[model samples]
Target: MSTSRRTPVTTGLVTALVGFTSSFAVVLAGLRAVGASDTEAASGLLVLCVTQAVGMIVLSWRYRLPITLAWSTPGAAMLAGAAATDGGWPAAVGAFVVTGLLVLATAGWPALGRLVARIPQPVAHAMLAGVLLPLCVAPVRALVTSPWLVAPVVLTWLVLLRRAPRWAVPAAFAMTMVVVGIWLARHGDALDGPLLPHLALTAPTLEWQAVVGIALPLYVVTMAAQNVPGVAVMASYGFTVPWRAAMATTGIGTVVGAPGGGHAINLAAITAAMTAGPEAGPERERRWIAAQTAGWAYLVIALGSTALATVVVAAPAGVVEAVAGLALIGTLGAALHGAVTAEGPREPAVVTFVVAASGVAVAGIGAAFWALVAGVVVHAVVVRRASGADAADEDAATSPSPTPGR
Candidate 1:
């Protein structure tokens, strides 16, 4: 095959490989945190893979653009940090459904999209950073507790970070697999039950707390961290994403997969560049083929979801979390930078970050929801005072009395 044809195929596979291996653990941790059983978490993983695959295939083929979909990684981090809801797994599933509907509504209602866009960027980033804090420290915690298992994984990640930056998380995960294999060998008969992929669906039951605590925060995070950035990434590569179509596809996919434990799906932010950029091919028109190829590749990866979950089930404590932490370290850094660097909202952003990282639940609601509330309140007060001060200064300068006094 010629280089043009091969590039799309190869890059498509790489994009899928890197995207899936790098963060699937985070998805599992999120589902588990929100009260999913091991089987249910595995089901979530499998269905998320299928839903995103379909979304990518349909969006790319229809638009003739390199548009790939992914599970909302930042939203997952929020889930990992969230306090379990009063209604348990069913409530979490309900929250997932609500998040999907909100995404769909955002596509249908221009005002809704505008409302989301109005959120201060610093506050949003601070919320994400706060949610990621505990997870990002897992490698350090794991190293302190289980150096034998975690040391090699961290070393592998560090070495790869300097050389092949894109492959760092995947390589660390590969090393973790080696550690899991060793653990299994030492403890024979560790494997149990079914290893093949299967769905374990939950009937969603809406609870007010879940809606307020999980669904609302989840919708905001998915929109701000994944969908918006994904559009920007594609645009940076000279591809204009069809916003409504993209949201409709991802929203519908999220709704369909909710019963199977998938949290949410949205545009691929990190992998979008790989699929849409010049790396896919010199011919811009043909890059859509790379996303289509990646869609098919995800189906192949889905076959291993159950086996991967099985290892996670049997692996030593903190091992999977260590990998998850390493995968998120870069994202945490980016979120923190975005949180602190905004000129006007810096103080309010810090307040948001501190509140979120506190992990304090109030009246059955998680800290994430409260963090946004507190940040917005502080922002309002600060901005109001600043504007008032500016107006007073302007009035004083223009006043006739000041000229008479001089």
Candidate 2:
């Protein structure tokens, strides 16, 4: 009996850790890339982890579905863009709240959620593929810069993922650390930096211009780019949950954690789908319970200590980047396959992919919004015409039958 109960719990915990470690470095790197001070970045990560865990727990328990929550990676990427413009941390927090509200609002409207649900699978897959493509490309570029450091880790990750899917993320992370540690020892880089982790808190202040202009756009991108695709991924895995409730939970968590410096909280599409899919559990319903457990565990990690952030920063950059890229390979491949393979809608899907990949922004809106728009328009024009033709044929087929009966 003890072993029976312990087995699922252990598996759940290990699965959560895989997701946590796989993306944790990217979260930190995103914070740093956006000009957050180390203290601010650490705080943001803590808040992010906490909110993500809470949302996952609440939703998973209520719906009894393996619904995992996560910070919007696209939102993080938006921050990277915002950071390039010297946006302040407070502004970023404000953006998170605004984005949370937008997600909440969209989720609140059942019609809108249904409408989003109506988006053709191909386009959604294309968008997902487009969003993740850059991540896949990044590791290869990083290898070029630090082949000695990143090559072994990447090769090992590929091997482990092929042979031991469950152990892949943790194994790659451990291997990367070993390689980096060895390199540092040989190169004599400072092994001992500040052992004590730094903590700082900031009061939330509203910046209307930044909120409306920067924050709003950030929210839009996070939802459209991250959350929508997340829903699609879940559906693909045969786990269906109400979009509004998911959005509401995500929003509430984001709002709660905003003061603590978290960015947009949204459904985790790719990684969560990977873990909660049939691969993670024998029964479908059990996966939701696992996700809820993961949420609670994440919250524990968030509030526990600064040691977490310290360890993350101490890891070699190449190792972290390579691991992230490698961990996402499965997801990236699925997204690519889905995006490029839709019947009769290939052109529009391809258009969406290219526009999103362009990374262009206009009037503060991110590329993702535009990509959706462009794809929708093309699909509407093309697919609508095809539908009309089909309707006309049906009408012609039945037309003389009424007259004969008369």
Candidate 3:
């Protein structure tokens, strides 16, 4: 028997599985990069998956919309090499809490969200592209370093992309799995880490430096990079997003997951497209089934957090990075196109991209925040100059007409 609320089982399952396999490696690698212990990273991964699944179920059920919630892939990317300037992982946890609160505010108060909405999209897009630049380059570097393992993965991705686009990422993952199996067979499962996940909470600590350096940037980037476009995606699919409800769910979810090392949660853009679109089903109203089913499927996958984390921890750094980077290539290209498509803001967008991609930090803050600020400055100056030129032209045109009439 099937429910009207759930029509596509296989679609939902694939969405959930691909969502985890394609990016879970990046999430673990990011936490480790930001100084989290393996156990802590495992906890974070499990908690986040559970949190997002719960959120997706809640929002989709309540609103009767195919609202897909996701742990912010871009946020994790931003935090990849960022350690708390003040208290390390605990401080990063604090930043996560702050980011969640900000997201809540955006949902609860439409006015504030509208303010965020007013931010120029080009700047946001530029910052996002810059943030993803290094990770996107990892595949090329991996090929240079370890051609044997990487060639197959990259080749599978390209061939599948041409042959069966939807299967490309999954095939890449399968190739990696084959490699993992070979490695594990050589070294038996005698690892000290438990196969099952156990959550360990880190007490949140706050410092001015942490707030400015980690918390602020995390909040802004997640807002611009994830949440803003997320709702837009829903709207494009003709679903009326209950702003407060959507924001509240993610904010609460983030708070719950953060203490367990989860970074932040937001509405899914890419994954949402998969689950909410026509490919999920022929009927638009019934597509909610896909998101709902995918939500449940994610919960099932969450059970293997420890196993997933172990594999990521054991894999060579280049291999982990290469896989993660390849997964994000499409995202990087889309973001870059968004950043530079408009003639009006091209300069500012470039400024933002360079500042962010350069990875320059100031005071305790990471490059992402400074990148936004730099872009805004450049945008303002250029707009001002253009405005002045327009004014001058108007004055000259008016004076010439007056002289001719006289």
Which sections of candidate 1 miss by over 4 Å? 401-406
Residue-level lDDT tens digits of model 3 in 86-167? 4778887888888888888877677877776666788888888898898899999999998887888899899999998767
TM-score of each: 0.98, 0.77, 0.93
lDDT of 3 at 167: 73
The whole-model C-alpha lDDT of candidate 2 against the native structure comes to: 0.68
User: Which sequence of candidate numbers ranks them by lDDT, best first?
Assistant: 1, 3, 2
> Which number leads on lDDT?
1
Which candidate's TM-score is highest?
1
TM-score of 2: 0.77
Clashing pairs in 1: none
TM-score of 1: 0.98
Candidate 2 vs 3: which has more lDDT: 3
Candidate 2: residue pairs that collide: 65-288, 66-288
For all candidates, the clash counts are 0, 2, 0
Cα displacement (angstroms), candidate 2, residue 230, comes to 6.6
- Compose the digit string of candidate 1's lDDT tens values, residues 1-406: 8999899989999999999999999999999999999999999999999999999999889989999999999999999999999999999999999999999998899899999888898999999999999999889999999999999999999999999999999999999999999988987847764589999989999999999999999999999999999999999988899999999999999999999999999999999999999999999999999999999999999999888998888889999999999999989999999998878748889999999999999988999999999988998999999999999999989987745555
The lDDT per prediction is 0.94, 0.68, 0.81
